[model samples]
Target: MKYANNIAAIDELSASEGVFTTAQAQRLGISRNALSHACKVGRLERVAHGAYRLSGAPSSETDELAAIWKLTASTAFSWERQAKWDGVAVGGSTAAWLLGIGDFHLSPYRIYAPERINSKIESARFGVRNVDEGDMAWMGGLPVTRAERTLADLCLDCEDPSLVEGAFRDAAAQGLIDSTKLGSLLDELGESKRRAALLEPLARALSASDQKGQS
Candidate 1:
């Protein structure tokens, strides 16, 4: 099959973000060999196995995660997928970093998915969990754990107590999350030592933020 507007079609598939999976290409009737040919001729750049970015497509910070997420749906187009498709979400420290909640520039990108994704990409660590709708948000078409949920999840997974404290303070200070809701969630998570340690600092931070706002 031939497409007169091949690059245009790919642009649409990538949502103008410059990264797409082979499955997306196939949906447009562009075959694996065609993608290879495009790459060989400098029209496309293969970033990962079964993943390609248009050579001329502009770059963005979200490109890497978006590419990997698309691989989760190898044979379906984005619109064809369910509204909360596959229960995939960017969570934990990575979510905090994306939201600029704290000083976190973590590698081995943290992800939450309903099942294990055996992709060739090795730079990510996936946790199997169901992300509730209210606990997640969409950023540039990528699903992410919302601020409260991100911090709550971090409190559970982050090894460094200080990091969680910093994220919690940042989220509270910046009004990125509802302290009341987060407090309830932490309580529901039970009275672990970590939760206890976080609660005191969270109270102090919120108190300071409130005073500053009033002043």
Candidate 2:
């Protein structure tokens, strides 16, 4: 409850965002009652059931995001596991990052899990959606659309076309996806005139890269 004690606990929790339950507080030489009292007095704030945050640390946002992801994955209501069960992948943007295709900067952290996974769970947690028909593939124990699928997803969802272009260019340059595959995906999507137009140039760029490799 004391200022110094609260500060020390903040440092400990910052190092590891495990919930500082009453039992853990006892080991820190602080009574459970004292910990509860500190929380009551505004020295700490409970973000989740037992997860506490210091009033001064604004960096809790990232920790909270990570915690939400873990919590969602652990629950029976999770779409992530369902995606696995349905033989769908959980990648695209998230997979692209794993594949070293591009930087992970797109919004909502796109996930390409199975179409059967609960849309509610996806919307509630990571804002996930189905992988477009063309670019679906498996990677790293999860089903994900290919790099081209990832680029197309970004193009559809991103507000900034330039950002999508940048990711497409980076993936193309790295040879992370196939040009013909990307084109096939675009044609399969069949509804997004804007997206098809945007991707056309990037797909050509990838084609050029492939031709250069053959030569």
Candidate 3:
């Protein structure tokens, strides 16, 4: 089966680097076998089972991370699609990036969805956690933990208490999350005593930082 037109279209879109799949080839009026042949001939590079990226494009660590996140979100579980269908937002580490809260330090990007969907999807690719409805909000067209919840989640999982403190301080300084909200999230998370203990101090520090900022 000929794939000259498909190849041309792919090459045009990926002048630098882009991703596509065998299914996409069929959608574009090309044969899957032809697409596979193109990959074998070094015309395409297979990044995952059904995903391919252009060969010889400048790839960076950030690009690799983003690709991993995309793959994990797409294949690791159905919760992501469920969240979209339910009109819930789903983002966490990525949200922190947008909110400028602080660096997430290799933490898995989080997704927030409706309570009805079970959020457990384990993979070596990335971490996924479910947030309650009240704490979920939309960010960049995806559901994510609210700013306060994000800060609390980070505090619960981060290795360095100081980093969590810094994030809380930054979020408060920027007025990205309210101090009262942070306290409430910490309180709500109190069932996990260890987590509450770990984050309470950071919350307090953030309150102090907010005061200093106000002054």
Best by lDDT: 1
TM-score of each: 0.82, 0.47, 0.59
Number of the candidate with higher lDDT, 1 or 2:
1
- Candidate 2 yields a Cα-based lDDT of 0.54
The 0-to-1 C-alpha lDDT of every candidate, in the order given, reads: 0.73, 0.54, 0.57
Give the per-residue lDDT digits (tens) of candidate 2, residues 71-118. Answer: 333332223343545434445455556556656632244454434334
What digit string (tens of lDDT, one per residue) describes model 3 on residues 1-215? 34677777667545522554444545556566766777888877776566566778655433433333344334322234445444334344555665677666333544434344343333222334456666765443334567787777666555466666666667767877776776776777767777767777676786677688799
Rank ordering of all candidates by TM-score, starting from the highest: 1, 3, 2
lDDT digits (tens) for residues 52-171 of candidate 1: 887877777667777777787766655555454568888988899888887787556788887877765787778876677778877877788988888767756744657777887787
Model 1 worst lDDT window (10 residues): 198-207
